[model samples]
Target: MSVTTTTPETTSTTQPKKRRLRTPYFQVVASLAWKDLRAEARGREMVNAMLLFSIMAVLIFSFALELDRQAQEATVGGVLWVTIAFAGTLGLGRSLAAEKDKGSLDALLLAPVERSALFYGKMIGNFLFTLAVGFLLVFLLTVLFNVNLFRPVLWLIIVLGCLGFATTGTLVASMSVHARAREMLLPILLLPVILPVIISATRASTALITELKTEDWLPWIQLLGVVDFVFLLAGFFLFDFIVEE
Candidate 1:
C-alpha cells in the first residue's frame, strides 16, 4: 500500500508588516517648549523679574524727564518699546541659560525631530511670554504716562512689535546660549541685528498713538512685517546648523 498521502501545501497567511516611523517633530518641540513654561511657572522667577524690571523702567521714564501731555505722548512709544525690549532680553537670557545649564539643550538636539520645529516652538513660547510683559507694560504705562495705550491701532503695533522681537530673540538666543559669556553676549549680538525692528516698531507705535496719517504708520508696519518674515525664515533654515554645533 503506497500510502503516499499528498500533503496539501499550507499557505502562509502571516507576513512581516512595515513599521510606521514617527519623526517626533511636533512632539519634541511641544514638550521642549512646555518644559520651559512649566519650569518658569513653578519658580515664577522669570515672570516676576520681568514684571519688576518693567515697573522700574516705567518709574525711571516718569522721573527722567519733565514732560507735559504732548511730550509724554511723543515719548510713549519709545518708553513702551524700550521697557519691553529690556525685559525681553532678561527673559530670553534666562530661558536659554536654564536650558543649557540643565543639559536639556543637548538632549533636545539628540531628539529625532526636524530642528526648525524647535525654533518655532521656542519662538512661540517666547512670544507669549514677551507679549504678556508688553500688555502689562501698556497698562502700567497708561497710568504712569497718562496716555491711552489701549487703542486698537496701538494694539496692532504691539502685535507686530512682539512678532519681530520674538523671531529675532529666539534665533539670537540659540547662538548666544552656547557662548562662554552667554548672558552678556546675547544682548550685544542681538541688539544690533534687531535694531531695524525696534526702530520700525517704535516709529509705527508713536505714529499710531499720535493719530498721524496712516501713510506714515503704514511704511513702518510694512517694514516690521518684512523684518519679522526675514528673521523667521532665516531662523528656520539656520536652526539646524546652530543645533548641530
Candidate 2:
C-alpha cells in the first residue's frame, strides 16, 4: 500500500477522458470540398486556365457564327454548354491527375475518411470550378453576343448540368488518371458516357434561352435529374474500387 503512490502525470492520465466529437457526413463533405478549394485558391492556376479558355472559346464561337440576333439566340445555348463541357473536362482531368501524379491521391485514400465523402468533396470542388467558368461565359456571351443568358430557368439548367457533368467527369478522371494518354483518354471516355447529360442539358438550355418556355423544358429537366442521380449513385458505390485500381 505504501508503494501505491502515483506521480502527477500518472494521476492526470487516470482522470476521465473527454468525449470525441463525431463529425456529420455533410460536414465531412464540406471539409473535403474546402480542402480542394483551399488548394485551388492558393494556386489559382487551374481556374485561371479554365476561365481564359472559356472566354476565348465563347468569343470565338460568338464571332465564328456571325449570326443575327435570332440566329444568336438559337445557337448560344449550344455554345455555352459546349464551352462548359470542354473546359470542365480539362479542369477535372488536371485536378485529379495532379493529385495522382503527386501521390496526394493515395495519401487521401489511405485516410480514415469514407470514399463517398471524398467523391463528394472532389465532386463539389469540380462543380464549383466548372460553374465559375459557366458564369463567366454567361456574362461575356451576354455582353459580347448580346444574348440574354441570366434567366432563372437557365440557372437551374446550369446547376443540374454541372452536377451530372462533374460527377461523371470526376469518376472518369479517376479511372483515366494513370493512363499514358490521359489527355486524350479523358475526353474520349468522358464525352461518350456523359452524352445524356450533354443532350438533356443542351435541350433544356435551348428551351430556356431560345424558346423562353419553361413547360417545354420540363421533360429535359426531368431527364437531367435522372441522369445526375444515376451518375452520383455510381460514383458513391464505385469510387472505392476505382481508387483501389
Candidate 3:
C-alpha cells in the first residue's frame, strides 16, 4: 500500500480562501481608514488645525455680523455653513498634501487594494474630521449666537453637509495634491464645485432653525440628499482616474 499525503493539496486549496477572507472590500477600506485614524490620533496635526480654524472662523463671523437678535437668527445659516466650508477645505487640502509629501499615497496605491475601497477609506477619514469640526461649530454657534442649533433636522443637515463636503473635497484634494500650490489650488477647485451642497445645506438648516413646517424643510433636505448622493457617486467613480494618474 502506498501512503500518499493529500495535506499539501488541501492546504493549497485553503490558501486562496484565506487570502479571500483578508481582502474583502469592507475590510480593506476599514484597514485603510484605521491607518489614517491611528496616525491622526498619535499626532493629531490635522484635527487640531481643523478645529482651531473652525472655532476662530465661527467667532469672527459671529462678531463681524454685529446683528440684533432677529438679525443673528437670520444670518446664522450663512455663518455656520461658511465656517464649515472653510475649515473642511483646509483639512482636506492638508490631509492629502501630507500623504503625497510623504509618498504614502503612492504606497497605498501600490497595494493590492481596490480603488473604490481606497476612495471610501480616504472619504470616510476626511468626513470624520470634517464632521468633528462641524459639531464643534454647532456648539459654538449655539453659545455665541444664542440660537438653538442642536435640533434633529439641523443635525441631519450637518451629516449630509459633511458627507457631501468630504466626498467632493477628497476628490479635489487628490487632484490638487500634485499641483505646485495645493493649499491654494484646493479651494479654487473645491469651493466652486460644492456650491449646490452648501446652498442646500444652508437652506435646510435655516428652515429647521426657523421652525418651519415639515413640508417646507423636506424639499431642501431632499435636495441636500441628492447633492450628497451625486458627489459621493462621482467620487466613487472618478477616484480611480484621479489616483491612478
Give the TM-score of each candidate: 0.89, 0.88, 0.89
The RMSD of every model to the true structure, in order and in angstroms, is 4.0, 5.5, 6.3
Question: What is the lDDT for 163 in model 3?
Answer: 93
For 1-245, candidate 3 gives per-residue lDDT tens digits of: 99987755444344444453337889988987898899999999989988998888887887888888887887898888998998888789777788888988888777777787888998899999999998998899999999998788789899999999998888888898888888788888999999988998998888777777888779988998998888788877888898766
* Candidate 3 local lDDT, residue 96: 73
Tens-place lDDT per residue, model 1, 148-190, is: 9988877877888888898899899898888889988999988
Stretches > 4 Å off in candidate 2: 1-24
User: How much lDDT does each candidate structure score?
Assistant: 0.86, 0.88, 0.86
Model 2: how far is 202 from its true place, Å? 0.9
TM-score between candidate 1 and the true structure = 0.89
What would the C-alpha RMSD of candidate 3 be, to one decimal place?
6.3
Q: Who wins the lDDT comparison?
A: 2
lDDT of the structure predicted as candidate 1: 0.86
Among all windows of 10 consecutive residues in model 2, the one with the lowest summed lDDT is: 5-14
Model 2 residue 226 lDDT score: 99
